[model samples]
Target: MDSSIITIFLPIALAIVMAGLGLELTPNDFKRVSKHPKAVLLALFCQLVILTSIAFVICKVLTLPPLLAVGLMLLAASPGGPTANLFSYLYKGDIALNITLTAVNSIIAAFTLPLIVNFAIQHFMNDGQHVGLQFSKVIQVFLIIIIPVCLGMLVRYFRPELADKLNKPVRIFAVVFLIIIIIGAVAKERSNIMQYIGDVGAATVLFCICSLVIGYFVPRLFGISSTQARACAFEIGIHNSTLAMTIALTVMASTTIAMPAAVYSIFMYIFAAIFGTLLNRYAPSVQPSIEQAPN
Candidate 1:
């Protein structure tokens, strides 16, 4: 319950995860963003527009507390990470596009995430209470997400084989690390579990569905292929709740604020899997490869 404990645990966990992220990536991953501007822009648009709007509605309609509401907004603001790439590969979505989107989104989120969270706190908690983003917390994000990533990129630059070899173990660590964070968060907030179960659970599921729907529709309107559309849908729909939890715990030290994201982490995985199955079954066939570069 101590603020210092939460602050200390959250950043260390996030930093480890970021280091795992770095171990798996190459400088080429970041470079891919420039090569696929359309896909990148499309994902960004969905994140800012569709996801944010849905989050606002959920927070308001569900009457989410200020901290939880802000947490949801933070989660929505984050981009797909390595997990999205793995999911995309599993679901036969474009792996390259997933990587490019993840790389770009992570970089953009440093600025966008704080802005979004701060706005949500102010908007939802119009009452006298004010919750602002601390400069120190944002700096922690920079250190956790950005700095480790740069180091990993350097590893790839100087030691390609070493980077490649670390990938599997790092990925394994990601899974374990994520599980611990979720479990610990749940344990810490065990008393509030019932209070949050219905509202946070239902809203998280709805948000995930909306994310997938928007993910598919926007790209389809832009004439992107069904496969890429599916990829974007999952990427944009299922946020990196880990990032949200990290920020909540490290910066705000409020378990209440971290609830939505913790709930979301569970919901998105289940919902996205179901959505992927339905999309693959019911969606129209991909016309022979169009060969257009992903924007």
Candidate 2:
């Protein structure tokens, strides 16, 4: 990618996409955490603790190249994308739960993303301290997520009709942007793209499978309803790779560390769809949806 594109344009484009996510959120989405404490807490634990630890073990066991390992870890650290709600709706999952999770996770990620990436750098990359998350970079990560999201929420709260109008287009743009980011990152590493995929592909695929499986079953084991469990599966399975890639290219300034997210984006939708199919087939016997999807 061109330096201007990566440095100047990427963040702006990503913020627009993120603001689109914000358009769908409201203050109530955050407050819903209290209403469904068990489900919400379980999902967050899987995202921050279980999935992250699994990613680390995969990196260590695979002995991926340092930057590649960090890339994988970054993907794991990322929160679920807005697409999760769409998939949740399609699969008869609790779209309201998905939206609530997205609302909360987006906020939590501001703090956790930098910490996880810094750890990956320190553990995987030897000169981690030099390229690590500094105070300014952490603030960049914070604002990049927080500001646009809050702005979008304000739009939703204040100008709801306009927010509703923006929602579909922005969501479309977000999907398109994900494709562009993957292509740009891959083109940047054209010569090594094949090797990079070979190294990280299995790890990404395994991570996706684990994410979908654990996302569903862990909730099931806790006796959460199947509808809600399906929501958990998709939310945990589909990551916001665009955010990961944006942080990598602009904030971390390393396309090498962006490779895992790039490759994972390719497999993510495929696996997510397949997992959705299986969930649909063996869905809960008598799950009734009382929650409506967000606009």
Candidate 3:
């Protein structure tokens, strides 16, 4: 929570995390999007439109505090976390589709996140003077997202062995960084932490459930295979809470605004596991021979 950590360490940690995500991505992932146009487009529509609308409705219906409302909206606008790929792999989803969704959605989020945040600020904050991410800050968001990812991709493209070597460590550091950010956000707003949970807790859980459901069922309803639907489920379910928290804590400079993401981070993985279990047991389209289905 120190200014030094907020201003310096957090951004660097975020960049490393984003770069680590890039290490998983490559030009082929983007190209793969072309092979699955329906899955790709529907997934984007769910992320940018449907889920965001659901988040807005939850904020309004729950009457979340203004900062907290913005925070939830911010999380909704965020792309799938990098971990979606891992979840997809574990759940026997289409890994290629997962990678494509993650890659494309992240790039789209750089622009859409700021727009969504700005709308949330104007609607929810009322008298709050925190100017939402303006053009300069939008540029900052783009750089924060794009540059490290591109650097990581370049590393992967050139020195794949080195990229592979650094990947796990960078991911470990990211998890540590997320824990610290959540703790720092909670610590900074300790008195309000309990109140925050009481207020936003249900909404976060509801949003998480809706995200997974919409990500999966909608795709299936449209005739997409269950494997692709599971990929969509995790991709849409496990948000980039790190990115949301970072933008809230560092870019927006509000611990209150960071609270929803911190709280959501606690529930996402647990729920994803449960959801995956049900899918694998009941309606799974993934072949059972895959080694990770049980893992």
lDDT of 1 by residue, 142-225 (tens): 667788777777777788898888778878877776677778788888987878876588888888889888987898899877
Count clashing residue pairs in model 3: 0
State each model's CA lDDT, in order.
Answer: 0.75, 0.89, 0.90
Each candidate's root-mean-square deviation in Å?
A: 2.3, 2.5, 3.3
Q: How much is 8 displaced in model 3, in angstroms?
A: 0.5
Q: What 10-residue stretch in candidate 1 is worst by lDDT?
A: 285-294
Ranking by lDDT: 3, 2, 1
lDDT of 3 at 24: 89
The digit string of per-residue lDDT tens for model 3 on 153-205 reads: 99999999999999999989989989999989999899888999999999999
- Which lDDT value does model 3 have at 266? 97
Worst 10 residues of 2 by lDDT: 286-295
lDDT tens digits, residue span 1-295, model 2: 9999998889999999889999999998888887677778888999999999999999999989998898899999999999999899888888888998999999999999999988888888876435668889999999999999999999999999999999998988888888898898898899999999999999999999999999999988998888888888999999999999999999989898899999888898899999888877867425654253211
> Where is model 2 more than 4 Å wrong at Cα?
128-130, 290-295
**Which model is ahead, 1 or 2, in terms of lDDT?**
2
Candidate 1 ranges beyond 4 A from true positions: 1-5, 126-130, 284-295
Best by lDDT: 3
